[model samples]
Target: MSEKKGSLSINSENIFPIIKKWLYSDHDIFFRELVSNGCDAITKLKKLEMMGEAEIADDEEFKIQILANPKEKTLTFIDNGLGMTADEVDEYINQIAFSGAEAFLEQYKDKTSEDQIIGHFGLGFYSAFMVADRVTIETLSYKKDAKAVLWDCEDGMDFTMSDSDKADRGTKITLYLNDDSVEFANIFKAKEILDKYCSFMPVEIFVSDPSAEPEYQTIMEEELTDKDTVIEHIVEPAKTEEKEKEDGTKETVEVEPEKKKVKILKRPVSISDTTPLWTKHPNECTEEEYREFYHKVFLDYKEPLFWIHLNMDYPFNLKGILYFPKINTEYESIEGTIKLYNNQVFIADNIKEVIPEFLMLLKGVIDCPDLPLNVSRSALQNDGFVKKISDYITKKVADKLSGMCKTDKEEYEKYWDDISPFIKFGCLKDTKFCEKMSDYVLFKNLDDKYLTFKECLEENKDKHENTIFYTNDPVQQSQYVNMFKAEGIDAVVLKDAIDQPFISQLEQKNENVKFVRIDADLNDSFTEEISEDELKDATEKLTETFKKALNRDQLDVKVQKIKDEKVSSMITVSEESRRMQDMMKMYGMSGMDPAMFGGSGETLVLNANNALVKYILANPEGENTDIMCKQLYDLAVISHTPLNPESMTAFIERSNKILEILSEK
Candidate 1:
């Protein structure tokens, strides 16, 4: 081929600047595009070799080599894959948007699928222009006696092509780093970019710095592989140590034998794990492997609760591992990373289009070669196909949870406290998931036992009918909890923030079922059944006496007779009103007074059997009567909720006066 120069096939000169600045979402994505192109090249070469169209040695290892030269202000990417001839370069490189991978797939359509190729648009090669002022490519095709070609472009619009003296059967791309992009020429920065985008690329990748002095490391021969380069061998002499005999005499003993070590050039480890754990079948993976992969990808030291391995090929090719991380606390953010990939090249993290919105609380990877990615591959093209993928993922997670509950209830319950928030969130977000996981939702009861909603309702059916009482804070509601326990009632614990909305959704789903807090109401079993007339008379007298003594005539008071003689008074908040107030607080409307909606929705219930109530009722005008009434009201208020500053101070002073009266007596 003769030396030639021509203008690029781009329509306008402004396209180069647009491609450099706005084509990709991030400036660092150029590494991903260029490295993935190399992966495609190697994959195509392997396919040809398998079909006997090209010859490749069995011992040959195909990889991508990245060399950063800070001194020279240049970065180079080398790949031992199917290189291009001069005509091929002119056709693919000279012509913008003409994808070489697409052309090869078209040529070999009958033999292979597009899954093996990572690059679809020819603009990937031009991504180098994003970080470089000038770019050059030297290559020799895999064909026998193929003439090497050298292609260079300064403005990315015009190019010069000529024959080259390059001897390798692959392509090498060199980028002259721009002043703003000089950081890419540093070895550490280059490696960081490779780790971000190419951690699981299909082809092995290695980063290097030619300007630094070569370092050497010693490795045992048993630990060496074909990838390691041996510099020299060393044999350490055996060591002797003094040992004490039974008679307390010291003796010499050989404690260690000679060891052999191989010194080799310390090369950077391969930045890519070609076969990630997600690609393997579930049956082929072990428990430890999933945990290790979770730690490696997410850098989370805490182990995951469990994982679901997704492997599908029938409808569309997809492989991944979805890990339900063990939440350490309720305050910890539930947002998790679900890395989206095409083939093995990472595209983005937490892509809600392919992963269900609820599944964003899980940490894992999903590689779907069939994803409908746009030209730059930075975002997904919203379509029905993407919806189907999201729905598929949601279904898989639901299936895993429901299956675990059915087969291994003990283990599922063990992970419930750590994983319940995720399950409840999932149920609230996805209807299909809710339908599948409804029966699997486990609630921790006050007895520290796990029970499903049906079990809870069934166990308390005769006592509370269809209502299942729960406690938000068992400590603050300990009096109510103990009262329920004394009455042989069961209350589940719903302490998580998501539990509020979750139970609301559950109520909508099950019309007959209701979730009431333990402190929301007083049970009938705690009160004696008195005649209507007598109860009305006692309620009227007690209500007037307490209201007058406390100086609050609008207070709602109820009188219950002869129920636990030691119990004096308690407060109850209406469940509906409490829920409304909570909703208001959640929406930042807590500043509004509760009386604006309805008069506090609180009722002070006084036990007629207690001596305090009896004394207050007998001597309504007595000096100590007001003190006892106010003390009882304050006690009830403190038990139910915190007392206001003024009310608390008054209550304390009144208690002290009563103690002084007792001392004087």
Candidate 2:
């Protein structure tokens, strides 16, 4: 046949501008598009063979090969599946065979594009123009006597087709990489793009580069076992008389019908695991296999604390394994790798709709064949299926955690430390997850014991009254922790930064629950009996002396007779007021006094039963008394917060003078 050429039929004269303008910024996508086209051709042929419409030669293996050469700056995708003829190319390119072209243009007419279905539309084959100056297609149709054809398109508009000697059934697309996209011609880059886009494609894909080690194709295999039909020949003694009629009944003949045996065939290497663990029944999988799969998917050396296997076909086809990894980086974003796939083909990583924002901290794989993707296939379209899938995932994770906590006490406690942040974050973000995981959420106390909110409430209901005492800083608030221990009460530790927001969330979730930081206030149990009327005069006198000595405008003072005389005094703050002040400071709001932090804008409780307070009451107006008042206030301030340089110097001077006086006596 003679060569023919003409402008491409489209709404616009050139498709490159459309692809370049609103399509994307990633230039390497062309490789994925072209490779996907090759896979599609293979798929069409496989479907034909399965339906008995065509016969694939046993010797002809269905495979996709990538040949990249940097020296020539050209990349070629070769497939041995199905090819095309010149007439077919013209028909396909004109927008009849490739259905996605018109739809894609319409979809992207306004919306910015994504990575999904870049190749789904017939335009995926044309994406080559984004990186290549010229692209050539040398293919031989699968017809018994179809001729080979060569089609060339340079400007992405005009193309020519002619006869060629490209002997093979499938297509071979060759891209002459432009100077700007020469990186795509690099062997490593080509291999990487194939690995990213075609890894899970349902075909045997091999990356072939001349520079490859030993000039071999890079082939990887994922095992998915199934029984194959094997033809078997059997021989047995026949039911003699009827079968041997022609041989005159004397001699018995053997007759047996051939039967097909279900045999397991040797699996070949492929780019992806066609059947992932999520695709199987949970009963069919074991703990060790799940752990190994987790390692392969996440590449994390640590075994996950637990995993939730999700498989549902009803509301929507949803299957995945969500793992609760052992989180150690409290300061870092708890962003986990949740790879989303559609029919085993990877779409994107950690898609928000499929994997909720809170579940992003989990490492897992979700493959939903019926997932709805908009024109670009970039993100999941908001639909009922998406909502159902997300709700199912959240429920599955909660069920797994709650089950483990109830069935395995030792294991639950063992993993509580590593998984607490994840559960807490999930509870804070998702109301339903919070509701389900509430019973399993745990906090560690000063006694090195883990307890849930229900357990905490049960133990402290009589005295603390649903108030959970927690310490944000164990070492800094060691004194307070010791007092709580002395009172035989356990104070939970909330040292991690996430623990702060988590505490607030816990309080918000339950009306009766309150998480009070150890230093946030003085519990009512720690307050001693007070004689307000009898000690009013002395309390006022002491409050006045400390105000003058500390040079403060106002001093909210109190006198309490406590049992533990070792603790001379402590500055107390209302939990509500302190939390408000912390909230204001955290937001960097100014105009608040720095000195207020020492007092938390609250009161200072003086232990009137202590020897020091007794001595101060007796010698309320002397110079010694003045120095002692300053020393006591300074001690409380230092314990409340680190002192300023000026305050520390004055406190030291006052202490030295008092020591000298005592020594002289």
Find the candidate with the highest TM-score and give its number: 1
Per-candidate local distance difference test: 0.85, 0.75
Tens digits of per-residue lDDT, candidate 2, 206-319, equal: 665555444222111222223232232223333433344655775545455433333233333455555668888999999999999998777899888888888888878888
Off by over 4 Å in 2: 96-120, 211-301, 329-331, 500-509, 590-600, 619-631, 637-665
lDDT of 1 by residue, 1-665 (tens): 78889988754544556555455648888899889889999999999999998999898989999999999999999999999998899888887766453453344334322223334465777788888889999999999878999999996677899999999899999999889999999999998989999999988899999998999999887888887899998887789999999999999988898888899989577989999998888898999888888999999998887888999995888899989888866568888999999998989898777888888988989999999886678666657888888888888888888999999999888899989988899888888998899899999999999998889998798877889899998887787888888889999999888999999988988898899987676767888887899778878888888888878858888888747877788888888878878988999988886778773678898888899888887888888887788889888887788888998888888889989999999
Candidate 1 accuracy as lDDT: 0.85
CA RMSD of all predictions: 5.5, 12.0
For candidate 1, list the clashing residue pairs, or say none.
Answer: none
Candidate 1 stretches greater than 4 Å from native: 99-120, 220-262, 530-554, 598-600, 625-627, 642-665
| TM-score, predicted candidate 1 vs. hidden true structure | 0.89
